[model samples]
Target: MAVEGGMKCVKYVLFCFNFISLFCGLALIAVGVVVQVSMHKTFRIMDVNASAGPIILIVVGLLTFFVAFFGCCGAWKENHCMVATFSFFLSLVVIAEIVAVVLGYIYRDKVKTMIDNNLSDMITNYKVGSAELRETLDKLQETWKCCGAQNSSDWKDYGSDGQSVPDSCCLEVKPGCGNGTMTDTAKVHQRGCSDVMSIFLKRDAQWVIIAAIVVAVLQLLGIVFACLLMRAIRGGYEVM
Candidate 1:
């Protein structure tokens, strides 16, 4: 009777955990969609290719969605095979999340430098680029209230006459804000795009890491419950 009661307890606990996993999977999918849409609007506008980070979230979410079914069914029916399958998939997900966390940390440290280099190149070639590129840079400068990649000086050679900053860098909108024999520091943003973008990237990366940690914790819990239920089911069979 003790063994039967233990098995019943384990079964319900596993069911409850798996139920939570189902919603977690859906949440991940939603997060991925939001990230993708935001990246598409900003990065895509700058002609920067979107990273695989968001896609990874969606893939992991889909995998979790399917694996959760095995866990739910196994616990409810006391099926050893189903429970074992759940354990295997859950372990894989845990491993993947760990790898992602490590990579995320490494990337976070390098993001600022990478953005600096990319923005520098973009600023140097701003005038020779497509209209879309020009418009994107203009909008970025205005929205961030920033100037060139590293400062207004980075645009020393980018003006139409090769002596001023872009009009978008102006502290206030006006005609010929970018026209002069020399850059007019008094009329333009003083900050750099590199610094502004670096702060934004760091914040976004932190959130990604937090989300991964949460998912990893939940997966670990699911694995534990699945194992406990498996043992209880095996013991009950042996007693019969």
Candidate 2:
């Protein structure tokens, strides 16, 4: 009689597990699909480095869907064999999730390192270019200090051919100089550059955070469902 009573409880737990798993799995799949769609362009054009997390989420979502389906079907059938099989599968999935979480953490560190490296390079280049500009400005200041009072007489002696001037001398060009290094320099200093980079970096960080949270939640659910399914299997065996 006690065995029968326990079997009834196990059956109930299995049913609850199946229902919860189904809902969670479908929700995760939906979230993955949404994230994938929204981040497609960013991964394709702006930042390839951050793309892996979403893709992993998609795979996990699909796997969860199937796992939940199998669990639900096995529970509904009240078949000990089927329940045992899926329970084993769920255990394996939990292991895989653990491994994936570890890898995701490692990859997160790598992403941070890559971002740091890129930022360092940008700062280095910007400083070098700025120093060059500063040097030119300083030279022009010195020249003006010595030549200002003398006016055009001093200018005439120096000749208009800028070639005669030191490379450190500043020349005023037509407003629209041919787009060359000057344009590249402008791009580095553009207000938009920092904002764009910040947005992209933030996106990457967001994806990482999402992946971590999703994995944690799924792992917890998997463990709970697996235990429920195991109990159901034991109950079915008792019924036999």
Candidate of highest TM-score: 1
Off by over 4 Å in 2: 45-49, 116-240
lDDT of the candidates, in the order given: 0.78, 0.50
Estimate, for each residue in 1-240, the C-alpha lDDT of model 1 and write its tens digit: 256565566678888888888887898899888988776545643335445667788898888888898999888888899999999999998998899899879867777677777777777678788887787788888888898877888887775566788888888867677666235667888788888878887898788789879878878987887888788777665311
TM of each candidate vs. truth: 0.84, 0.53
Clashing pairs in 1: none
Specify the highest-lDDT model's number.
1
For candidate 2, the clash count comes to 0
Model 1 TM-score, 2 decimals: 0.84
Give residue 62's lDDT in candidate 2 (0 to 100). 73
